[model samples]
Target: MAYSEKVIEHYTNPRNVGSFAKGEDNVGTGVVGAPECGDVMKLQLKINPENGVIEDAKFKTFGCGSAIASSSYVTELVKGKHIEEAMTIKNTVIVKELNLPPVKIHCSVLAEDAIKAAITDWKSHQTPASAQEPRKAQES
Candidate 1:
């Protein structure tokens, strides 16, 4: 099958491709795999607690072009954004931006899950006296 131009661009020149060698020992790691679809994605991130910003991201994906691109895009999206802002990023944004097909929508969900997992992992590392639970979604 032929990949879309966006997928081709990201897979060929993925951004934020490596680990932060000495990133926080508490780096958050999220792994999602869908056997039926033959896709597996692992997203890891290093976040700054003071600012709740993603400092670095690395991913290992096993799947088709859309899956690869979705993971790649999320990595780019989260960097430098406050954790809460990153969490607010919607799959619709990914879908619209990547122009993903209906059949591949789950790929965007996987990217969202990876972001949540990474943030949860970051929260887990906080000292007992300092751990801040992720705030709930506030409806407007």
Candidate 2:
């Protein structure tokens, strides 16, 4: 398969390659698979609690160059973005950014889903205790 120079570069010298410590509340990780291409991607993220911003991101994708590039690029895209902002990330953006071919576009979508899942998990955890409970007092 033909890959872009940038894709090759990233695949050879990928950034943020390792996983963060487990049970770390601020860290989010996503693993996705594509049956057609037999591609599997694992992307991780570290978000800042105070601001709910993505402080760092890493990936351990076991797929082709496009999958690797998508995850790598998403990690870089979300480095300084707040969860709300990051949630707005679209697969189209990734596709356009990488100029991904039609057959390889699914990989980019998986990368985007990974980011969304991480953000969603973070938002769910952020619900205040009061919001989680409706009754504050005991009934007599």
Per TM-score, the best of the predicted structures is 2
lDDT of 1 by residue, 27-67 (tens): 77778887669898888888776777888788888888888
lDDT of 1 at 58: 86
TM-score of each model, in listed order: 0.82, 0.84
TM-score for model 2? 0.84
Clashing pairs in 2: none
Local error of candidate 2 at residue 34 (angstroms) = 2.1
Q: Give candidate 2 regions above 4 Å deviation.
A: 128-140
lDDT of 2 by residue, 4-110 (tens): 77777777888888888765667766777888888887777788878777899988888889899888888899999988888889999988887888988998888
lDDT of 1 at 28: 75
